[model samples]
Target chain A: MTAPLLRIENLSVEFGPRANPIRVVDDVSFEIEAGGSVGVVGESGSGKSMTSLSILRLVPEPPGRISGGRILFDGADLLALPRNQMPDIRGRDVAMIFQEPMSSLNPVMTIGDQIGEAILLHQDLNSAQRRKRVLELLRLVGIPDPAGRIDAYPHQFSGGMRQRVMIAMAVACNPRLLIADEPTTALDVTIQAQVLALLKDVRQRLGTAILLISHDLGIIADSCERVVVMYAGRVVEEGDVRSIFRNPAHPYTRALLKSIPRLDDERDRLYQIPGSVPLAGSVTQGCAFRARCPLRVETCAVDRPPLFAFGPSHKAACWVTAEAAQARSAAEASP
Target chain B: MARYIFWRLADSIPTVLLVLTLVFIAMRILPGDPAIAALGDNALPDQIAVFREKMGLNVPLWRQYLNFLHGVVTLDLGRSLISNTPVVNLLAHHLPYTIELTIAATLIGVTAGIPMGVLAATHRNRPADSAVRLYSLVGYAIPDFYLGALLLIVFSLNLGWFPINGGGDDFPSRMYHIVLPALTLAFLKSAFMGKLARTSLLEVFGKDYVRTARAKGAREGRVIYRHALRNAMLPLTTGLGMSLLATLSGSVAVELVFNRPGIGTLLISGISERDYAVIQGGVIVFALFVVVVNLMIDLLYIVVDPRIRVQ
Candidate 1:
């Protein structure tokens, strides 16, 4: 069997004072195989970004620190590697496309200079060679009039074009895994689709594994083959896209799935998960998702549920999934 | 751009007229008579009257102002009351020295202070940054005269490196005399300039693009200079504009303290002897210098930023 490209095991990140470092990502574990796509769906305050930032060791220091975890890229412990070695690993091994494209790009620099800087830093290319490669990278990213557009500033480009430039920069080094964090959030719906298609096309051409983080269920549903549902700071559910879509096991996942507005005969009142993602102190013991979980039993509040795999692939962290989970699942599916 | 330059030149005309009017009125308003200095101290009222009539001081203030404006327009400043030399000739001789001094001081401040600021800001929270901060603190606290004296003692009097005091006999000799004085003035302004550089750079480093640069595997040096430092320098341009203003004004103090023969000496002597022509002409020229320097600074603002230039 082919080995998985990326594996994150028991990863946790904390920020604030050491004595009581606020746990932002708590024991989150997942894996993505080569050329595979995974979507991490969560709300604004969820640990989605923290998890992504940890992979590249790009978390801002002083308060934010990766407390515990093994970020294994092809079974190598990424967290153990030194910073000098990591820069090559970052853009060359795992590239990241940030959410705010305009801010992430150097405003004073031209589009060509900014893109060429990536090549100049990591590769041994002279001015003429880097210019050729930079122009090629701009062309490959589907920028029209690539020769002329290379000299434009960030402000000179429209919002969509700026994002395309950002995409071009990220893929300039040709990494295997691309982590796109809300890549389409700042764009209009039409522009959002165009950018998303550009990302999808690039992934297909390069055969790069993509960890797409988004709050938009439609984008996730359309883009990812597998999905990891996070609540508070922990993974609440994980499954193949078809299984998760057809039958969501955890009540939080169920509520989330139901909440997605379907085009056909949708209810006038859209379904919403009651209450917000729970506060840290409010759900200190047991499962972090228990307060919002509709299937909260006596055992759920006191003792957390381990992720029990019903099939070879599907897994859900819920107290109801015990020896009788398969029977319970079939009974529920029978209408 | 053509329209803007035309407007600026047109705008300057009224300013020159206003300054001419003010200087004419002020000379008349003062208590002392310029004719007194022209005549002997023990002269009678009749001698004074005769002296005043000959010197054109007996004319009414409005008529005197008109004559002053006419002379200014004609490019003829009448002879100095005490020296009996044309004010134009004296200014033409002394203005170069003051200009050279101010320019040297400005160059020194810009060259030395920007690097110090960049270094201090980049090395923030470290000992080097702390030391720069401390040095600048000491620099800002002390007056320019005391510092100039201290420098003179260390470099000229003790080490015999620079000339002690006096104007140069020639251009090269004048430059030798100017080194200590220019450096003195530069050193005074650089404390503020350095602090401005480092603080602005530090602030720029905190911006999002700096992070973006670093994330792209940019070396720390290039990241700070290309991405952070360039942006940081925008605000420093504003400080530099104000510094030019301060530099011209500070020449009076620097020239006075060092005894280098420039406008400062002319100004002080002009005031003491109450030589209205010398004082008025000198003040008017210095005022024009300050205003023109400010205009050049405004023009420089456009050069550094294209967006500003286009607007």
Candidate 2:
């Protein structure tokens, strides 16, 4: 019944001078249904965070700029919003969680005070109501002894707990969307699971659409319903969680899937994606992943591929996907 | 935090003592008899010797040191050889002027430098940032004395905007005179502070917390002053502390250019006449003031930021 919460179209971000901009987000588009979860998976410098930052208009300054983009949130053009209106929108309609929990929360302020600060900024809650809501938010985030711990500083918290505090602050105003940018990367595996579970629970309770960003496939698998794969600042593949896991089309996407170590894998060796994420400034012609792709062909080196649909919900950008699939079948049949 | 303060205070005591000791040894060991220097080139050797004995110059080095230590302990600064009055009295009269000048300069330096630094960092690599950098560079190039003279000529002599020299008989006029000297002193120090603030702010702006603040939707102004600027001020705090002492202690040049009766001028005239009491008094007082100012700066570290106090 509710319209899709967000729709991004042809979003390209560039960092560096306008004369020769280093493109980081290249015409990436996707949609998140209301209360839906989308996982943006990629490695460091893969522009996952940049995508989220572009959505929030939080890209690092001067050299970095949104060169071209149209971000539609519930049919409203986000990029078209005036600069003065952004503060009113942020924390009211949307909020974000950062990667480093230890530093994300202001160390100098009490957890209670930090949460109250956001509420005060975005909501019309008075002092007493603010205090009550802060405690409620803390409790909602599963912080034990909420009353006692409200006055504690960020330094007093463990990594997992600090992240919970960050979530509480982000969710203080019950925003419609919450972007978690590598929200649990720094935590241990167990803590990561806990954090992911907490996020899942929060989304269920508040009906908040989550845009989860992480490099780990396991994190994406557990925390997201749809997956968007980024490479060299472009979406190489995107699909529903089921289709993406079962059959990935892009070489980069397939390579990424194979790179994840499995407990029941062959005894020979763990597969690697072979090459690094291309340096953002150096990608000049054709596909940025062409240099390392296994499905390389003449077209791969000469012309960049556009996204082609494999299924209604799945799409990929690869020059020789058809040939690569036929060749893969021939090799499998020969073996 | 209390322990940190106690240790910082403890560390400063020896610094004060060592400086006074150096001042004592350096003044006494220099190859010139105060008696001859005070009495003039034509004075008889016997007359100089009598003056030395009367002034306790005949005592051994260790004994004189003991006497000096005793005087310091008892807070007895003794008489000014040049003024023929208590060194404490002379210092009390002139010290206020220098202190006022130093405070004014420091206030100017901090206010101007901090904002300039913030602006430079925010608009880094742009014309505004470059302009601030250029200003500090120019500040560095011009000598304080030359700047002081130029200011006097332009603002005082030609413009008739202020009295050319001295605080004068009235408190307000004296304060007005101090303004030019303070501005000259601040101009030099502020460039350094401004550059430090800018570079430091830029660095802090790169920090993860700053990124976090931006993501949290803090306004640009809030992200800068409230978030990035506070952390950047840590380094400035340390540098400014030491500079405060240097500016206050080195008021001699500007004071001379402006005919202000500050401790620097007092010390210069005292040394010229071999006025040992004035020299001792000036050195000890200046040393103690430096020590105390540094201590206050350390204490201020916790106040400018709550995180430091938390640590």
Candidate 3:
């Protein structure tokens, strides 16, 4: 089997002083295959975005530090790479798109200049060639009048168009992976669909692996083949998108699935989880989701459940799921 | 852009007129009469009366105001009450010295202060940052005259590296003699510029575009100079404009300490002698200089950031 493009092992990110650190991302592990897509879904502060930022080593320092992690890309440990060498790898092999499109772009720079910056950094293109590539990238993003809009400033573009320019910049160097952190959260519903469609088109055309971080399950389901569900900085469930959505193994994942407002369901009100995700570093023991988990067992308070496989590509970090899987496997083996 | 400049100039007519009127009234309202001041207190009452009548002091206040306004409109500033020299000629003679000192101070302030601010902001919370903050604080706290005197005592009196009096005769010598006064003004103003640059750069660094620049595989140096610095320049430009005005007016204190024959020194002497025409001309010219600098700053905004041009 071919090696996965990007593999993360026991990654942890901490905030504040080392002595009394707040673990924002705790022992999370996942992989993205070459030219494939993976979605990380969770509520705010669930470490979904932190995990993406950790991949790029872009987490704000002094306050944020990658305490423990092995980020292996192309069979090499990225964490062990020298700081000087990281810049070459950043826009060349991986690029990131941030939320808040209005603020993401440089206000003073022309769109053409901003897009050309990445090409100038990573590619050996001359000024003329860079200009051509910038125009092409702008055109590729479906921007109207790419030639005219090239000289336009950030404020000249609407929210969705600015996001498109951001996409153009991200894909300027033709990176292997694109880490999009809530790319559509700042856009309206219709514009969100358009941006998502643009992302899909970009991925398909460029054959770039996507590590999509978002809170919207529908977006994840629509865009990804596999999904990792995070709860309180830990991955509570990981499985193929269909399996996770069809049969969520972890109670937290199940609750999250239930909370989504359905057009078909004749409910008076939307379902809501009982409690919010615990603040970082606040929960030091037991299951992080037990406080809000409806099917949490007494053992959940005593010991943290390791991820147990339920099916070929499905795993959940819940004692109930683990025990049921164990009993089912035993019964099947006896028959 | 041309139309905007035209409108700005047209709008400044009222401001200039107001300044002229205020200066005229202020000169008259002062305790000492100009003729008396020119003639000295030892003069006999008959001699004082003859001097006052000759200087047109015996005219009605409204008529005198109208005469001054008419003289201003005709580009005639009359004569200095003490020396009897044309006020325009006096201004022309000393204006160069003040302009040279102000330009030198401004150059030093921008060149030194901006770099210091960038360094302090980039190395934030480090010893360098603390040192810059302390420097700016001291710069803001200390008066220019006090600092100028200290510089003179150290550089001129003690070291004897620079001359202690009036602007030198030759251009090279003038440049040399102006150094201490310029340094005094520059040091005070640069501290202000440095503080402004640091705060503006720090704020720009927090902006999302700076992060985007980093994500683009650009080097840290490129990220700061190319992406962050230009955005930071907007506020710095305003600070620089204000600094120009401060240096121009604030030079009065430095000129007194250094004994330079600049417009500031002339203004001080004019006030002492109660030279009404000289006072009126100097104040009007200084006000015009400020208005022009502000207009230039507005024009500079369009060049620095094209967004302003579109607006």
> What C-alpha lDDT do the candidate models reach, one value each?
0.82, 0.85, 0.90
Pick out the ten consecutive residues of candidate 1 chain B with the lowest summed lDDT.
B302-311
Query: Per-residue lDDT for B186 in model 1?
Result: 90
lDDT measured at residue B75 in model 1 versus the true structure, 0 to 100: 68
A1-335: candidate 1 lDDT, tens digit per residue = 87789999999888888898788888999999988999998887678988998998888775698999899998898899987777767676787888887687776678899999888777889999999998998888888999988887787787888889888888888878889999999889999999899889998998888999998877888888999988777888898888888877777778887888878945899988877877642456787776676667788888878788866688888877554687877899998
User: What is model 1's native contact fraction?
Assistant: 0.37
Candidate 1: residue A31 Cα off by (Å):
2.8
How displaced is residue A60 in candidate 3, in Å? 0.7
Clashing residue pairs for model 2: A16-A63, B167-B174
Please report, as a residue range, the 10-residue window in candidate 3 chain B with the lowest summed lDDT. Answer: B32-41
By TM-score, the candidates rank as: 3, 2, 1
Question: What ranking emerges by DockQ with the best candidate at the front?
Answer: 3, 1, 2
Chain A TM-score relative to the true structure, per candidate: 0.94, 0.94, 0.98
Model 1, span B1-311: residue lDDT tens: 66666677788778877777777777777765666665657779998888778667678866877787888878677878788999888888778888888889989998888888988987777898988888789877887777778888999999999988776878889889999889988986687789999989978877777776776777678887888877776788888878877777777777777777788778878878777778887988887886687677666655555445434
TM-score of chain A of 3: 0.98
For residue B131, what is the lDDT in candidate 1? 82
Q: Write the residue-wise lDDT of candidate 2 on A1-335 in tens digits.
A: 56689998999889888888888888889889988999999888888898898887888767688888799988998899998777777777889998899877765567887788788878888999999999999999999999999988778899999999989988988888999999999999899988999999999999999999999987898788999999888888898888888998888878888888888888578888776778885776788899898878888878878887777788888868856665777898997
- Please tell me how candidate 3 rates in CAPRI terms: medium
